[model samples]
Target chain A: MAVINNKNGLRIEKADITLGFIPLTDCAPLVIAHEKGYFRNEGLNVTLSREASWAGIRDKVGLGILDGAQMLASIPVASRLGIGGPKIDMISAMVLDLNGNAITVNNDLYEHLYAIDPRSEFSPLIAAQALQCVIEENKRSKRPKLRFGVVYPCSTQSYELRYWLASAGIDPDRDIEIVVIPPPKMVTAMTDGDIHGFCVGEPWNTLAVQQQLGHVVATKYQLWNNSPEKVFAVSESWANENPVTHQAILRALLKACIWLDKKENRKTTAKMISQAPYIALPEETVALSLQGLSLKHHGQLPEKVEDFHVFHRYSANFPWLNHAEWFISQMYRWGQLTTPINIEETVAAVYKPALFRIAAAAIGLESPSIDRKTEGNLHEKNMLMKSQHIGPNQFLDGQVISVGGIIKYLEQQSLSKADIPALRLINIQKEA
Target chain B: MKVLLIDIDDTRANKLEPILAWTGIELIKLNNHNTDIYQLVGEMHPEIILVDTNSPNRDTLEHLAQLNKASPRTVIKLGNARSESINRLAADAGISIYAIDNIPTKLLQSLIDITLSYFYSIEHLRSEIQSLKPEIDARQVLNNAKKFITETYGLTEEQATDLLSKNANRQGRTITEVARQLVETGSFI
Candidate 1:
């Protein structure tokens, strides 16, 4: 029964908070939050319901099977906008991590890029352009579009890579393609050259760079500089009914994020995330991943590290409305939003910034990037929105442009017989 | 039509049915040979697809990934987000984050709305393609007719179209049928 003022009383006291999470290194927050008495601190019992795919999480959440989850920042935006599937209203409460993802090109392509340019230097923007040039040149000789991999469609990596390439003037739809590959299989998949590169989080990016199979072309930090990565999202009703419980959970998580940011706690926190039940890779793998953040042994550009994944930096925890606006812009730019959106109201409704502020105040936490309106231009080369800014134009950079209605723009250039970019899979395997 | 459970029965499964009912979600079950996961994906193309995390099926995640592209806007369901094993599988499949249930119905709808809002573009893209097929086909036929006129009348392609348009007006019939009649019957009908 729906909760009324004082008569029906909410069942949240006994309600289950079935959280879902993917197994990537970034999933550590959910694990740490739950494992470290975070959920209990909030007088709540949350079942850490691990899931199969971004699809699975969405479905379970839609049908009320699971409550909320650690989701791709775009997932909430996509779900609410209903671009990938049926419109499912969702939102991100907290910005989990940042700058964990990277673009890893396969060895053959890496060598091929070098062979063509002969200057295997450290310019991701130029390399991206060079890669596009190679794809275009090869197109004349019947070279099929090379496949690149991202974790999911509703992932920042997908948009980032697309945005990155588009800024360099490469059409993601027609030029180098992106396919979704799980992090575990990313390296092996890259080896086959079935996928030329992949954009993924943590150990995987470190894994690729360490193996020398590929190099990091760009970090997500370069894409949007502290863009929301992932979040522990639940249904809005759940939070509304269980206000104190929600605050408690946030308080617990507040501790985790604080611990994660500490220089002394990094080793222990990394160890915890790399646990057998967690990211279960070798300690060395986890160490390498953590080391890659600061160390430059793996060809990772140190310059990108300054604005890398700041766990508690710059209001990362604050689910600001402007941040919502930024994502909405991205949704429109990427053809994720089909209809006209009430971006302002939608942002207010989707983002629980007020709740976040309350939690931040309770926890006595200070967020970096005090102003969410700072319009920051991404370092990657996504110029389709040359004059489009994904977020509010509040950053110091005048280069920021609005991503308003870029989908309509891409559609105008790429309308189908049906007047929309209707994508069909290249392979329709027979039911064998 | 009831929403298919897409999995076998158990306590959790049985409880799921009523819970969904309470939440105003009426889904059915199709755990039999009639379970043409592919054909159903093509025809029925359910709004939501629920798959078990433990099922030994050929990476249903992969299948759903492909289906996501084909089905256009259908959602594929999994149990929870904490299932890292399954989450990895789903991520690799190109599915969007439609729903992640662990909170309450409000959060679920928030996620759903997010999914719906996000999917609108791609789904609209699908509808756009679906709606314009006939027009495109007609245009193609019109082009073919224009080409035929270019060869027969020894006129340029542009001149042939202009000639066809003028003649079709004189015939008092549709240009497409007139163009077809001219090409096939070798005379204007």
Candidate 2:
């Protein structure tokens, strides 16, 4: 492998590193970095290990067993706040990708939803309200509650699923059950009648739809456009100790993201990631997200979504502090966090946009100059402008998640004193 | 009465159900095999968890860690003999007792007793070590040994720690004992 000198004159602390990733289409950047010799060009040896679950990724990264990992966008924030897992002071300087997740419901649920509303537009609110009807019927009939699956308790899938449901007046806590099912087993679980629906990343969603086990109700793009999905995360201590290495990794990943965004390269990238060592799914299944084709539903016509997955376009790699705050607000809104936390401090400690800026600048990539932006206020007129701002990032309910808005939202929800036992059940672990 | 059995296939369940029944440990077997094991354990409030599988995966151990957080329970894993590193990983992931390979049904009860006693003693020692100064030096030595093993064998830090513990168990010694040997020799088998 050819080695290039550090052009930025920064000392590389560690040349050899191992990064962890769950087997999913969104882990493409890390795989592309290693396979395309991006890491080798910077004088680094990168080993990409396929992790079993998000929790395993969190634990291994937290314990310093692995240097860094492709983590759930909320994992670092939740870990820092000590909400769903151990407090590990994790940080993410760059986001891996955006909006590669979809909500998939089993065939039975899909039929029920379609029967309720056979509309062409895949509106999350409409689907959620139909789900509300199913939930009420189940309650009235004294049947077992409908169980839905998210990849992790502290994940974008969890928040998005909850947000979408709550928008339709369905109480996620009492109306149904939410469980964590690893992405790989989601289709099987849905087929086994273990879960009625799940919100997860591709190609699991695509795979389920293709297998005729489920249908896509809504993509994350429909719920919240270009929402932060997976992030490249490491412990804060790891970053402090290996600043140069971290920057180098970030630069390589940014280049990979750039390489991935080219429409012509999507086919090859899809084929590359579908190998057994990487995502291990069919190339066609992985290609569906990359080619930006309409996702096929069980009964409804395919929905054409162009921004299904954005890797480098519109400064998608930059870690936004506001995104972190939005997650914190969601955590509070859903009763995952019962105590008030300083959102500014948590964002400062976990979302390091300055580091991302340095890496982007070093690689001659233009990143968002500003570190924060108000979410849920994008219009088509300003969509193509090349500024630090990127959007179409609106919530289904049209509620803006600004700093003050989150504060007011949390206060209105009274999450600090909610004291819901079912909410607290998942967080039973003693602090380590 | 709160006992949870996970991944216990019908064959093992058939063999183990009678044994557990005789002991009056009402086993609440998990039927949903795809849900998060840790979250299920949290919801069920199982005081004791028994997992039977071919080998424990990273998900299993990670869930065990989560289970420990919600409520520390006596966990027993019965399966085929995995690599020493895997056994070590299982232990680190919070399985109190990891019994590799099948054992005669007659010895199962006695094994449980010994495992319970062993867990208590280790917990007692852990608390004592938490308050001692020498423990810090020992930890440093262990850390150095783990680093050495990781660099030399190209194993992950978790895997290296597992190897050390596995060696210690095989030699009928403690982790500190095996760590000292690795630290002194600067090599691990």
Please state the Cα-based DockQ of model 1 relative to the true two-chain complex. Answer: 0.05
Model number with the top lDDT: 2
Please tell me which predicted candidate would have the highest DockQ against the true structure.
Answer: 2
Q: What CAPRI grade goes to candidate 2?
A: incorrect
TM-score of every model versus the real structure: 0.63, 0.72
Clashes of each: 100, 4
| Model 2 lDDT per residue over A1-432, tens place | 333457676668888799998888889999999999999888898999887677667766766668999998998998888676556779999999999998888888878887888651376788888888888888889999999988777789988888788778888777888777778877887888889999999999988888889878788888888899999999888999999899999999999999998889889999999999988888998998888965657455456566788898867988989888778878777767767455677788999999999988987777777877777787544677644446577767776655344464444442233433433343332222
DockQ of candidate 2 is 0.07
Interface RMSD of 1: 6.5
Give fnat, all candidates. Answer: 0.09, 0.09
In model 1, the runs with Cα more than 4 Å from the true position are A1-16, A118-120, A291-307, A366-372, A377-398, A401-432, B1-50, B53-189
In terms of docking quality, model 1 is incorrect
Number of backbone clashes in candidate 2:
4
Clashes of 1: 100
lDDT of 1 by residue, B41-109 (tens): 556545444445333221333434433553323334333233332333333322233222233444444
